[model samples]
Target: MDDSRAKGPPADADINLTEPAPVEASLTDNPQKLKIAYEQTILYARDLNLKIGELKQAEKALRQNAADLAVLFEASQVFLSQNNIETTLQTACQLIVSRFDLQLSWVGVLTNDENEIHPAAVYPPHDHSDSHPLNQVGASSAAGQELIRQAIHTTQAVASRYSEPEARQAQPAALTDDAYSLAALPLLHNGEVLGVMSVYSRQPDYFTPDRLQILQSFANLTAVALVKARLFERLQLLSQQLVDAQEAERRHIARELHDEIGQTLTAVKINLQAMQRRSGVSDLTASLQESMDIVEQAIQQVRNLSLDLRPSLLDDLGLVATLRWYLDRQARWAGLSTQLTVTPSNLQLPANLETVCFRLVQEALTNALRHAQAQTIQVDLQQHDKELQLVIGDDGLGFEVEPTLKRVAYGKGLGLVGMQERVSLLGGRFELESAPGQGTQIRVFLPVPPALAEDRSA
Candidate 1:
């Protein structure tokens, strides 16, 4: 009933209705207080600016760390993916040159003499002309110029600014600009310097401590890979030597048995035959004939054993005749049809080549007989101007090729590995093709001089 009066009446007794109340004391009005307020505002603004700057710095650091991790990841992938030293260095250098702010990258292996760092792989920069070139600098020099040499000698990472005279002298040429730095890390494994990895960048002081640590890790991984490759190569060499020694021993034994036992048997048979012809008593003649027959059989057995050890035909008649003889024998024994085609019919190969070809064919045939359950096989051999090629094929149930490779790598398929090593030792190529149900084929190419065939034929 009186809502307006009730809302207005209780507050009216001693109050001014219209005039604004006296302004309260505040920093907004007083000079000093206002100045203080302005100063505080400025201080807060400055603090905000500083905080933003710090946040930006943190963001940049995070980005840099991410890039470093990515680079390390790629280096690790390189170590995992590549088994060859040349390919590994090439790929790893390329990755670094592409991903990082780098001008050039190179990898050099320490020679056994420890005198030189031979450049194994190099990744040139965007402007190839301005790129820092790799120099084969001596490790022990008075100049102290070679970062790579220093790193290797100390088995540590070394860094230098491109502007330094000694560092500049160590580089291939003057940089297009002075804004560059260099770092060299020793590739060390088990306390030995395997090689050196050098990187060039377009920023001064590019090799920070954090980056140096990552690079050192990369170098270590590279060294481990190099060691593994070296061990494999050494193992292959030892295997080849063992195979050679075995062959030599076989040849020696075969020669001794043929020369000593074969001749004696032949002489004994001739004497017995003469005795049989001259004997007066029937019983004595019969006994002499029987002895002659026994000696002849023994001689035949000795000849067979000698041939098996190392065929005289392989030495005398050469690979062609021996292969023909062997193929004929295999056809009879294994009951498999074989077709062999050797171009020019009068090809003569080096002893190693002949032995490798013969062994390859022999092993192929043996595998077919023992495992393939195949009926027919084909072999093609050709001599080219710069290479010799061999192709062998079979019509049998095939198998997965990858698992076989893994097995060979782990030393299980020695026959296959032996064949491969023989070809590789001669700088040849060997390849196999197969599948679950189709068939199997082997192809080989051996780099050879054209004159090799002609010289042997002559």
Candidate 2:
């Protein structure tokens, strides 16, 4: 091949193959310089790595902060809207699991036992079940359980990590480096430790001290809400008792009027009639007849008062019969046409439930007749599934329902509020619908106990 176009290497005759290759003048020529250069490069890499690590930590912190805020905002909204304790706790658990994308979350309350806590609620929103209500704490996740105890005992937040196998095995066993995270936060409020709430995540070290602090804030809110809920429930119970007392008082007064006063008035009227018949003088006869007429009016007034206070039919004849009689009498007095319907006409209910039902209808009718200028009123009652339903309607000049109820709630009027309170105290749902130039309608749904429903059905 031609030398100019050849691709192969030159002939070996011109090269020194046996001799050592020449050294280039560079840092390698001096051990000191080479070491210094290598050290400098290492230093540069170390500094860069440190800065990068710090930035990553800062970014992670910001992301975690945003997540914490989102969780708190959503939970606070629920806390603001719902005042019921069970609802608040249940919703809080759901929010935590949903927000954190957590594996599970559970709430443990102070039980009779001082050494351990009991599960009050769990995540995934169970169907009113106790099976696995404790999620992982009751059975395993030993590290988590200990942390829960420590958090509750100290009223502080305790955190740890656990692997899936460790969690599933649920033994109070040691955990490995690679594991899920668990944070036990105390439900501390008013300087009292009510219980503990624990959350789990697949991401190890997810609940850092700062993250736990944010969760603790939510736990604190949940604790306060629980206290408020407890107080509210107690208040509801007292209010229910108050209503029951009022009903009893009314019954007592009605009985007194019907029995004692009615008899006395009747006796007086009979004596007056006897006196008028036996008297021969015209003046005396006229006087006696007037006295008898007054007695008759007095007797009629007493009877009306007795019925209005508390009708005997309410107790002796059940809710349906009592409602029929009450609606009829009120309709006649107000010159309104009343239509009442009851499925399974002989429907019977518990005494307290019957009283509540009767009172609700009574208030609705009174409001419709006295305020609505309604000429036709309808009352419907029926039992369906696990609840009793009642609907009352009237063709009257209706007013704004919300404003009226708000005013009533603020003590402006009791007509609308009394109806609502009566239903609420019994843990029932009450809704009012009305508008100007439109007739009013009141809908009520009262939960019936399973046992009571069975009895009624039988």
Candidate 3:
């Protein structure tokens, strides 16, 4: 029984005592494996850090993109809802600066000559001084000038660094210390450049390709919005002008009726009553003659009024006859010499086109008489295949063409805008040529509808 506890297990007990523990066995027996495992763990931690950094960058980019999208979406809605171009553009500039953390923002329109960029909308509005500091910076600096030229000439989005020391010196005091990068996106429609949207950013390489694309689209949307707003305003003005023209026509008709017809009828009635009171055959005859004279005068007055309202010849004969009648009448009334020439004497035109042509000549003659103080005016109408061409020229005091066009655009240039609108609505072309002291010339070309052309040929 004592053998179970001692003598048989002596060697086994000695072996167990000499053997290492599990934790120590791993470290001491396989040092290379331990080092490899440690290296692997370290590498895994380093990889995890790198992945985390990449994830953070991705998140940041996502957030920026989201913010950009939000700003653009809101801007679209703002532009859509806004009816005034100035308000729309100003609000857009303000939004861009605030949302994108930009230093400044502006929208510039190319002048008619395309030689200058006039600031249309600006954030942190320029001072009341005659000179716009930022605008001067844009015009004066080489980089700034190139940026504008590139965008306008190429009709694309252009970007340039605006960190030149000289350019910075040209900046206003508020923006002198800060660096800037400028991006110009051309406002384009149907391959024509309307203007440029200039944005300034603090960060370098801020406008990525994606960002630029978004901005270009925004610029395009803005261009369309501006054009729509302009058209809307023009329509409103036209509506008001139409109302005014109707009122004026009504007044004129009323005056003519009162002055000519009413007076003649009153005189005739008085004479007839006098004749009724006196019983002489000669008196009756005299009264009858007087009444007939008055009647003839009244007839002439009515005829004039009718012609003024809408010439019967326009509906009966055509545009050419109406033009001749109106020009003769106006020339006689104004004591101005006038000449009208129509090629292919028997040429025909659409009814509406004829009316338009007549009104255009009438307005032109009126302007020449009233404003131009012209001695002579000439009108020429020609049909060239599928197009009708008209030229109205006057030897009179002229005006600055560009300024006059501006006035017309704003609804001010004595019926010139109306003429342009009429031509444009008919898918026609209108052009004006004038200078100080030189005579004014208006040229219009209207395309003939296929049906009308066919009718003429037939």
**Winner by lDDT:** 2
Model 2: per-residue Cα lDDT over 12-121, one tens digit each: 22322222233346857798866655554554455555567767989998987998898888887778767677787888888888877876678877865656677777
**Model with the higher lDDT, candidate 1 or 2:** 2
Scored against the true structure, residue 160 in model 1 reaches a CA lDDT of 69
Q: Who is ahead in TM-score, 1 or 3?
A: 1
**Prediction-by-prediction clash tally:** 0, 1, 0
Using alpha carbons, what is the TM-score of model 2? 0.81
Model 3 has a clash total of 0
Clashing pairs in 2: 140-170
- Model 3, span 1-458: residue lDDT tens: 23342222332232221222224456667877666555545544555555677679899989978887787788778888776678877876787778777766778887889787877898758665534545544433465677878889889898865555754665555554445677888988777888888877766577778778878877887787788778877776786567457646754675667667767776776766666566468767776767767776776776677567666677778888878888888878888898999987987887668867887888888788888889999999998778899999999998899988888777797598778877865768899998878989999999999987777667
- Pairs that clash in candidate 1: none
The window of 10 residues in a row where model 1 has the poorest summed lDDT is: 135-144
Model 2 residue runs over 4 Å out of place are 1-60, 111-116, 125-142, 163-178, 455-458
For model 1, residues 297-316, the per-residue Cα lDDT tens digits are: 99888887787778878889
